[model samples]
Target: MNTLLLHCRPGFEGEVCAEISEQAALIGVAGYAKGKPASAYAEFVCTEPGGGERLMRELRFERLIFPRQWARGEFVALPESDRIGVLLQHLAELPVFGSLWLEVFDTNDGKELSNFCKKFEGPLRKALTKAGRLVEDAGKPRLLLTFRSGREVFVGMAETGNQALWPMGIPRLKFPREAPSRSTLKLEEAWHQFIPREQWETRLSGDMTGVDLGASPGGWTYQLVRRGMLVTAVDNGPMAESLMDTGLVTHLMVDGFVWKPRQPVDWMVCDIVEKPARNAALLDDWIGGGHCREAVVNLKLPMKQRYAEVKRLLQRLEDGFAERRIKVSIACKQLYHDREEVTCHLRRLDR
Candidate 1:
């Protein structure tokens, strides 16, 4: 297998290709990416026999912003009469996998295959188990079977810890009925993707205070209230009556761009609709000035050169923080709930 399969949001295949190509070049790997607009996936074909494996080893998956999940392998054509037998024959040449994930693209056509995948999974697992090619070791590589169509599939492998925790790089989160708007899921998903579950008690405890910029009907503020935190919601619009009833949120009517908290806050979150650079600058000012110990904000992307724009904004934040002698850990991702924007988490480290 000399191709690296990558899963991404539909219409972002070019971004994925650009990111992976650049990352691979940085590591001295020779490869070219093939992507189609709205395909929901891309492939990087390596020039050398084991170059795909090398990229998988040397490149940290978390550092790449575009791809959600990645695996190194080749495509296989299966026969309709006996797909399980064909897969087992191929597995005979590879190492035992700790887990198996049967995935499809995130498009309408892919959704149609979900039932087929579900039915295929049971018999495939049974066959792999009988062949001693599937086991229950978390440390082992995960087998990735991405079905492009009924007869066409990509067989790949991803190390357990190096890949996304969910198949197709998507987390299935149910929208809370109590939230004022569906946008509330963005912050909830950000918490899941950025904060470690074990550290939630200490880092995101209820005693911590938070500020929500652009808070209106209180979608983002809803997350804070549910976590039992005292929140100062900044916006000129009225907040949800349900949220006000919680008594944990104080709604302020003011422009998010101009308002500043009187004192430092434990956390600050913004989902304001603004230019990416402007949003980034707001975050910079808050973190560099010690106004907030941590922040979760969204950067709305431009129509063209989206990847380049994101890279520039991220570098700007890093450089600005360094110049100010600020110590902070920054992480960004395009969460499933986001559209035309990416979420960023900035936490000030103890000096």
Candidate 2:
């Protein structure tokens, strides 16, 4: 295969194209990306043989900000008659796969194919197992079958431990009924995407104290309270009575932009509705001032030049920290629950 398939949120095809093209050029790979508006996926065609595979190996998927899942492969035309047979025929030419995922675009049409993919997986698995082309080894490459249509499919391979844990890079999280708003999933998903699960006990322990900026109605604060952490919620609006009743939160009526904790906190989270740069600056001040050891904040993006703006904001933070001689690690992602904004995690490395 000479192309890399990138899956992203619908209406963000342009961003994915821009991001992958820039990333590929940085690695000395010559390629061009093709994406249709609202198609929910993009493709990068390599200029040379095996260039796509090289990018897959050399590029750290975590460092990529746009694409949720990626694979190196080529498109294969399938006939409706004996589709399984044709798939197996192609599999014979490739190495054995650890597992298989049948995915479609993240659009209305794609949802229609969910049932088809589900029905087709069982027979395909049985056939691949019989041919010794599919195994249970986690170290083996994962077979990625992205169905653009019933008759057209992209056959790709994703390296184990180098791709998102879920298909299409989306984690399935149910909204907690107790949360005051659905916005709570954003923080929950951010935790899953940014922090490693093994470190949750120490990093998100009950003894840790936190502050939730713009915490009205207690959506983000709800996550902290459930984790058994003491929280100070800052907002002009009143918090949910249910959250206040927990006695773990102390609600303060103040502007998040002007509010500062009296002492350093274990964590600080913000979901304030404001400009991206403004939100970034708030995070910088908190982390640089040592007001919080770690922070999770959402940056609301502009409608135009979104990717460029994000890079600029990230670079600004890096520069600000360098000038202050403050060491910290920052990671940002457009979580499944986010809309026009991206969630960022900043942790003080000096601590």
Candidate 2 regions off by >4 Å?
none
lDDT of 2: 0.91
Q: After superposition, how far is residue 11 of candidate 1 from its true place, in Å?
A: 0.6
Q: Which residue pairs overlap in candidate 2's backbone?
A: none
Give one digit per residue, the lDDT tens place, for model 2 in 159-247. 97888778988889998999999999999999988889999999999999999999989999999999999999999998999999999
lDDT of 1 by residue, 1-351 (tens): 789999899988999999999999998999899999999999999998899899999987777787888999999999988988898898888899999999999899899998899999988898898889999889999999999999988999999888886898899989999999999999998998889889888888899899999999899999998889999999888899999999899998888888888889899999989999999999998988889999999998866899999999999999998988889999988888888888999999963
Q: Which ten residues in a row have the lowest lDDT in candidate 2?
A: 59-68
Residue 321, candidate 2: alpha-carbon lDDT: 98
Best by lDDT: 2
